[model samples]
Target: MAKGKVGKTVGSLGDYLKEQRVGARLSLRQLADQAGVSNPYLSQIERGLRKPSAEVLQQIAKALRISAEQLYIRAGILSPDDGVGGSVELAILSDTGLTERQKQSLLDVYASFLALNAADGADDATPAGAENDAEGTAPITTEIDPDSDNRVTNEG
Candidate 1:
């Protein structure tokens, strides 16, 4: 069978790899260990100083716990749907070392942070209420139910 053509785009593969690595908050050494590749080699690949073979890409995808197709698409080796937006956050959450439960936990924390920030912003935008305590602080209490998912039960 004829070999498929690889992308000649400048730094496309390297950029993709680097982005994925950073998104996962992984160091070069960690990715190297997981991918069974040397740290120097992965570094060179991320710098566009080296080209990796298809077998190496497969290993990387396995280590990253993502589909080979996704890696191929990122590497410019395959074309996939461009309709769905790609998320660096999601890529990070997909790391092999992370369990589904851990990812959910991280997502829940992030959501709560966002909610708190939004609430603060809203308070700042509104006029001061007479109910403001002696410290002139708006009391917002977040209650978390152990049985429930990260949905906040507002005690306000």
Candidate 2:
């Protein structure tokens, strides 16, 4: 790894690398050999003591048979734009049936939907004022009568 301004090593990136290596059933030495890095260096990376370069990460990704973009994301070198539709987005991008403009529109809409869902979840979390509420309301519950299946009852 060429020297760069090494900020704090990203813990998620280290964890991801370790997990991938283990999932592939590759020893630390084997991964280092395949990735053209040192065993000690790889060990440091896995332990979150060192941050590997993007090229090194790409090589590691290749050795693990995983997407380089995934490693880049874990390393915090790249932002995740695809969200849950990663493979779908890749397919859409490569599809010859759609024009570039059409593809762009589709991707934009998809990303917007993900963003909206995330925002909705954020709002669903405890609100600022509600966190200080001394009197809490009981959660509503609904149940069906076991004896008569058609009967419904609501309780709080």
Candidate 3:
């Protein structure tokens, strides 16, 4: 890829992280402290001037109460289709210190989590009733056919 494209992707990821931090009511110093990274280094990462390692990404995700895979996707280190479980498992398996048994255990746990989430989503999407259950609960339905570009219906 071109350098400009890479820079743009990095900048976009940085912007997203900054927005998330602000939304969580956290200051740069607070996030830095929580992530166990230097304020200047975190600032640099937030500005897209520095690329953080997977470990640093995990630390930031933990501090933000989010999945590190999500951060990895935003940073272009992983794709959205890879999913959190797969990406995290792959990252852990790549670590030099982890044994094969440990990697397998982690992968199994991640797979179970993904399966549970998928099952929950499937249950929600099933037609429980014609309308939503309650004020806070609603059924989500998407009509877009992935195989066809003409499936999109623009509601004016």
Candidate 4:
């Protein structure tokens, strides 16, 4: 992978990993041991000082008892939009670490955002003429006078 791509997400990935590790109540050494990596390396990963490989991410995910796909996405190894529609929902649903209630909550929020966007788009979809002629007024007509200097003339 290009350094630029990994650089863009390494900090975010590190932060997420640290949060997950803390939530799991595991020490850095413990996680490193479980993931079969050295303590310093794991620390570097957590501190955003180093970008981990996909294999390392998978191992860490296994150690943390979370979905490898989630780590993959965080690490920029896999795109959240890898599939088609509902990819975000799929990622949330597939995470082994989140409870059913948490997953449902996330799904609800996503649906709400989508609905809001659709509603806003609907408001913008009103016909331009409809708004101008809401009072049942005819549209203005204009014509060019052939006998004059080609000036515009309103035809009532």
Candidate 5:
């Protein structure tokens, strides 16, 4: 491919990967080691000088602890979708370390875990009262269920 085409294709993806890696507090060398890629190669990917294959992106996503589908969408390898994230699961399925039964088992367990969390969130979420406080002023309250296991504490 021409340098221009490759540059355009790699640009956003490289930026996305670099952002995720940085956000995850990983150095380029650390990310390369975890993703099983070379240090210079990862640097090239981050700088929009090289287009990474889907498999490399998957490995990088795994190392970054992100969903592979997100990387796939950023890479233009797959379009955005609203359903359950199957691409990450598909990556797990395709991995050589896991056998067929192991992959199926892992998928089943992961699905169940997601379902349980969704159910828990649905049950715990409640709107704060819209009434004024003892001082005749509306009291600021949280939208999050403090009793729940969510990481965010929403305030209004």
Candidate 6:
């Protein structure tokens, strides 16, 4: 990475960091303290005079209560595709109640479910009617029995 404020990407990253800090209503000194960085260094980063490392970016993201992946994308450490995840992933990542390990586990499970669904979709390329009409295939149907405590009952 180029140093000394010449890089446009670095400037944009710095601009984004400043925007986030301001949006969080944090002073430069306060943000620096929360991010465990020096005020001068943080100011230099905001001014595009220096490009921060991924670790520093993560600290800043935590301080700003934002996604570290967003910071990584802004800093050119991760591509948009690499950081791509919908609201569920964002919620999981942003949930402060979960430990890092628990968050990672949940994310892993969610990714696996997505992959499984995608594979199933790919395998459904046959003619639409043929899918359910194939031999040994049955469409499972469920109904909530009013008589029973709303328990789901499998019909076919």
- Scored by TM-score, the top model is 3
> What's each prediction's TM-score?
0.43, 0.48, 0.55, 0.51, 0.50, 0.50
1-156 in candidate 3: lDDT tens per residue? 677776887788788889889988999999999999999998888899887766788789989998777787676655577634454765774687976567557766876777887887788875436455654555555467778855554432
Look at candidate 4 and give me any clashing residue pairs: none
Residue 140 lDDT (model 3): 56
- Candidate 2, RMSD to the unseen true structure: 14.3
Stronger candidate by lDDT (1 vs 3): 3
lDDT of 2 by residue, 49-147 (tens): 887765677689889999877776676554476555377565655567877568667766876886887897787976535644546654455677889
Candidate 5 per-residue lDDT, tens place, 102-125, comes to: 765776687677688778769875
Task: Report the alpha-carbon TM-score of model 6 versus the true structure.
Answer: 0.50
> Clashes per prediction?
0, 0, 0, 0, 0, 0
Clashes of 4: 0
Off by over 4 Å in 1: 1-10, 80-156
lDDT, each prediction = 0.67, 0.74, 0.76, 0.80, 0.75, 0.78
Error of 5 at 139 (Å): 72
lDDT string for model 4 (22-131, tens) is 99999999999999999999999988889886567878999999987788778765557645645786677667788767866877687687678778778897755787
Write down the TM-score for model 2.
0.48
> For candidate 6, lDDT tens digit of each residue in 24-50?
999999999999999999999998888
TM accuracy, model 3: 0.55
| Candidate 1 local Cα displacement, residue 45, angstroms | 0.9
- Give stretches of model 3 more than 4 Å off: 83-156
Residue 152 accuracy (lDDT) in model 3: 59
